[model samples]
Structure formats: C-alpha cells, structure tokens
Target: MALLHRAELRPTKLDLLAAWLPSRRWFHGPAGADIVRVAGFRFDDPAGAVGIETMLVRAGDGSVHQVPLTYRGAPLEGADGWLVGTTDHSVLGPRWVYDGCGDPVYAAALAAAVLAGTGQAEEFFEVDGERKYREPSMTIASSGAGDAPVPAVGPPRRVVDADPALIVTDSVELVVLRCLDDGGGERAGAMLTGTWPGQPTPLPLAYAVPR
Candidate 1:
C-alpha cells in the first residue's frame, strides 16, 4: 500500500519552501518575503516509502503560514504539470513535488487513510453550535477512484446549542469525534483527529479545514 519514507531526508525546511510556496495559489507574499523556517513534522506513508511533511514558516513580516508537501524519489513522468519543482539529489536528490491533491501516490495513500478511517481536520461551526464540513478544494491525483464520500452529521443544527460529532468516510469509516472547541476568530473552532489505514495520524489541528 503506497507509503512515504521518513528517514535520512536531505532537503531542509527552507529548501522545501523555496521550491514550494511560490507555486501555490493561496500563498500571499510579495515574492520577496524571505521565508524563515519555524517548525515542521514528517508523516510516514503506510507503505513506508513516500514522505509527507507539514511545515510552518514565517515570512519577513512575521506572518506564519503552513505548507504541506509530499516528496518522491524519481520523476512522476507526464505528471510534471502537477509538480511545483524538481531537482537532482545532491545528497540523495532527484525529487519531485507530489501534489497531495493530484499526485497518484499521495492520492491513493490519502484515500486509503480516509478509508481506513483515519484522517481528520477542523472546521468552523456556526454560532448556534453547528459544524459544517466541506470538501477540500484540492484534488487527489491518481488513477484510483474518485474522492471518498464525506458523511454528513444530519441536517444543519445550531452551532452554539448543539453538541455534535464529526465523522468522515469513503465507502468505509475514517474518523469520528465529538465537539472539541467553540467557534472563535472569524470562524468557529472545531478540530478533527483520526488515523489513516496505513499512515500516521495527521495533526487535525495543524491546518484549518480548507474552506
């Protein structure tokens, strides 16, 4: 089952950002906001070969942003259109940007994780204590099947008054959880947590559920 390796990786977090952030549509910077490495973590693919990382970086203005990246050994030919960058391994180089949404390796791994019942993220609920989960805007690239269905929690309820639970699935169960936090900021505060079939559990709080 396709997996990511998490050992002896060479690229420093900054190297990753220099090659990644500029390629994303959501990256808000003047193209000169020098990136300062902050913190990051690696997740092992269930197959134990591919590597997924969630990195936090601060720009020159002290703005912090999260960058989620996937790495692969050889080039994923014909998939260059989906990649952000590629370079030879100076120290085991020869890596390619595996778009989590479109890269087949990552797509299947994520699907398996979701199907295995382990992949969760947080979303903002309304003020009445209701949580609404939306499908991510990103697409997983793979010759595999389409996206797994995200289960609904019944009709929309009051965000502040109801004590609801969050669940996700893809023909099989993925994650289930009760209320974690109240709505705050410009949105509600609902965190998601679960484990994938063969991969490490992603930190649900690491990313705000993509709107």
Candidate 2:
C-alpha cells in the first residue's frame, strides 16, 4: 500500500520533471513546452525504503512520455550522472531523486514485479485521519509467464546507447521504455506494461535480459 501525504513539496515533481525531461534522449517535446502529469503508477519497495513511481506525462502537443523515478533519503553515490535534482519533502525531509532506470533498487523491484506478474501498488490517501483506497490513474500488467526468477542485482553500472534505454546491472541488462508507443516492444520477450487511462491495451514499460 502506498500512502500519500497532503504536504506541499518545494520544486514540485512536475517542475523538476519539466527541466529534466528535455535532457533525456527519448524526450521529443519542444523547448519550454507545457507538460502535465496525465497518469501514474507505483511499486512498493519490499524493504520499505525507497519510493518507486512511474509517471506518464503529456506535452502540450499531445506527446506522451514515461518517467520512472526513485526517491531516496541520501544521495546515491556514483549516481551523479543519473541525478535529476533534489527537493524538500514536507514530511520526508530532504529527498534525492534519480531516474529509476539507473537505480538498482528500482531495477530489482521492477524485475520482481515483472517476474511475479504483479500490478501497481495500491494507493491510499489520508482524509481527516481516515485512510481511503483510491484507484490509480493507470493499470499495469506484466506480460509473459515463466518460472525463471529475476536475478538479484546491485547498483546499475552503466546505461547503453540504445533505443529502449538499457541499464547494466549485476546480473542482467534492464530495458526501460522511455517513450509511449502503441505497445509493441518485446525485445526480451517479457516486460512490465501499463495501460493508458480508460484504455485496455497494455503499453510496454520495461523489459530484462541476461547480461
């Protein structure tokens, strides 16, 4: 379960993404385009340490992009190149945000979810001290079935210069879908997928392959 606080954040998430999104190779938006968070989903850190979220944002020209982000208490050493920015959370104090594609925690969590065929984390909001489950903006589905366990991995060593963003981990290479296409990516034959709000077709989110 994911509990969302009603606290304000300095340099709100959208603002941070606005500046950082254009830096990605997959970003197709024009400079200074209006970007809005259209949908999102989350994965729980089995250890309850980091916040793993995937946001689907739409540009003013109707192009959609997928951003996987991780929030940590301390800076991820050796991840300077992957750092998006830092922000202050009213309830969580300071946060170090990074692209999940480069974070090991995110890679492992995503691998587990895909291998286990799990969906997004259940969301809950606090209203007058009452907890209420709120439906997420999108639904995710892990495609492919197999008993092969997802290999455990350490910090991402590096990213490859490929169309589907690839992250080199300890045991495998993680492929993250940087853009929202019509859901036809299957390089690894298995992937984590998400559906657009009100849509039934699943779009590829990421995949994995042996290193």
Candidate 3:
C-alpha cells in the first residue's frame, strides 16, 4: 500500500514538473503556463526502494500529457541527466525525483506489472489506528506477453530510448510510452494501460514486447 503524507513538500511536485516540463519535447506550453494535474496512479516498488507514480497533466492549451516519476531517498547513481531535481519533504526529510524512464526501479516495476498482469495498487491511509483505502483517480492494468507469459520480472541491463521499445532485460524489451496513445500496437507482447477518471476506455501507458 502507498502511504499519503499530509506534510508539506519544500518545492512541491507541481513546481518541479513545471520547471522540467518546459524542457521536454512532448510538452507544448510556455514555461509559465499553469499546469493542472488531472489524474494519476502509482505502481508498486516491491522492495520499497523507490516511489513510483504517473501523473496526467493538462497544459495551458488543454493538451494532456503523461509523466512517469520516481522518488528516491538519495540521488540515483549514474542518473544525473535524468534527475528532475531534489526537494525537502516534511515527512520523508528529503527526496530525489526523476523522469522514471531512466530509472531502473521504475523499469523493473513496469516489467513486473506488465508481465504479471497486475493492476494499480489501492491507496491506503492510516486513520485513527485503522487503514482506510481510497479509490484512485485512474485505473491501471497490465497483461502477460503472448504464449510465453513471462514467469518473472528481470532486472534491466540498460534503457535505450528509441520509442516503442526502451528497456533491455533478460526477459523482454519494455516499451515506454511518454504520452498515452490508444491508436495501435494491438500486437505488443504486454502493456500497462490506464483509464483516466471519467473516461470509459483505457490507453496504453507502457508495453513489453519481444526483444
């Protein structure tokens, strides 16, 4: 279960995204444009080493964009280029945030969810010594590859970004979809999909196809 903190974050998630979004090719907006977070969901990191999240944001022009993020306790080794920035968390003390595509933790979690046919983890909060679950704004799903049906999640050796397929692991090639697309790829080995709040249909979020 993912825990929600009631404390304040020094720079804030929106602030970091606002600064980083302007630098990405997919983001179409002025640097000062007001970004509204529409919907999001979290993927579990089995070891709890990193906090994985994906947010769907509306740009100034009302265009929707999907951003996958990973929060870590310390700076990720050999990931300086992918660092979004670090912020002081009132609850966790400090956190290092990244773009997620380059994060091994996020990659592994994506692979596991895609091949294991799991869905988004339910969010829970501790209230008066009891755990209460709250439905997320979006629903996420994943499915196994074709007939082989991956037996396990393998650690990735590297992530070579070239669209459609990104991560190279012992098992399969994981695809990272920066912007949610629903057009094609009906033949992908496995995929992680999500349905935005109030949306009846799901879109491909990530995928795992044969290497």
Candidate 4:
C-alpha cells in the first residue's frame, strides 16, 4: 500500500510540470499554457522510500499527457538531466523530483507491472493518528498473467524523447506513452493499461519488450 500525507507542497506538482513539460520533445501543448491534472495512480516502492506516482494532465488544447515521477529526499546521482525540479513538502521537507524514466526504481516497477501483472498500489492517507482509505483516481491493469515472472530491471541506459518515451534498460525496453490516445498501442505486446473518470475504456499506458 502507498501511504499519503495531507500536506502542502510549494510550487505544486502542476507548477513543476508547467516549467518542465515544454522541454520535452513530445509535449504538444503551448509553452506556459495552463495544465490541469485529470487523474493519477501510484505504485508502491517495496522499500517504502521513493514516492512513485503517474499523473494525467490535460493541456490547453484538451490534449492529455502522462507524466511519471519519483519523489526523493536527496538528488539522484548522475540524473541531472532528468531532474524535474525541487519542491518543499510541508511534512516531508525538501524533495528532489525527477522524471521516472531515468529512475531505476521506476523501471523495476514498470517491468513488474507489465511482466507480472501487478497493478497500482492501494492508498491510505494518515489523518491525525489514524489511516484513512482513499480511492484511487485511476486504475491500471496488465496484459500479462497475474502469476507471470518478471525479469530484473536496471537503470535506464538511454531515454529517447519521443511521443512515447522509451527507456532502454539492460534487460528490457520500456515504452511509456506521453500522449494519451483512447486507443493507443492496440497491437502492442505485454503492456500496462489504465482507465480514468472520463476514459472508462482501458488505454495503453506503457509496455515492455525483452532484449
């Protein structure tokens, strides 16, 4: 399960994206345009250290984009290019945010979700001294069998900036869709698909191919 804190964030998530999104080669919206977060889901880090979240945001032109990010207390070594910027969390203090494509933890989680069919993490918010269950804004599933075995994934060797960003690891190549089309990647192999409020039909979010 993923634990949540009801705290304030300086230069909120959307603010960070507004500055970082236009730098992406795949970003279709105008620079400095308003970004509205539509939905999101989380994946638990087994070690419970980094925060893994995937957000769906709509651009000014009604185009939706998927952004995966990891929140950490310290900067990730050798990931200066992937840094999304820093934010001060009310409870967690300073956080170093990075695009998940360059994070090894995210690669491993994506591989597990696609190859083993593990879905989004169940969430609970700590309210006062008790834990309160919260429904996820989005849901995800995989084409692989639930009991399928997942291969070990390492840090990305290369990240291609494209409409569907590609993360090439030692064991697998992961394709993460930046643009959210209702019928994205219909003929893809093992993949992770998601459904949100307006989009009830599952659409491909990411996929993995063994090297």
Best candidate, lDDT-wise? 4
lDDT sort, best first = 4, 2, 3, 1
- Give the count of colliding residue pairs in each prediction: 27, 0, 0, 0
Models sorted by TM-score, best on top: 4, 2, 3, 1
Quantify how close model 1 is to the true structure by its C-alpha RMSD in Å: 15.4
Worst 10 residues of 3 by lDDT: 179-188
- Candidate 4, 123-211: lDDT as tens digits: 99998899999998989998874645677888889998686888999898899998996456564558888899989988889988877
Better of 2 and 3 by lDDT: 2
Q: Name the 10 consecutive residues with the lowest summed lDDT in model 1.
A: 154-163
Q: Report lDDT (Cα) of residue 58, candidate 1.
A: 62
Candidate 2 wrong stretches, greater than 4 Å: 182-184
Candidate 1 displacement at residue 105 in angstroms: 3.7
Candidate 1 clash figure, as a count: 27
Give me the overall lDDT of model 3: 0.75
lDDT of 2 by residue, 1-211 (tens): 7888888789899989988888777787778887899899999988888999989887677567788899999999888888989999998999999988878888887777777676688989899999999988888877644647667777777886345788887787778776675564457647787777655677788886655
Q: Which is the leading candidate under TM-score?
A: 4
True-structure lDDT of candidate 1: 0.41
lDDT of each: 0.41, 0.80, 0.75, 0.88
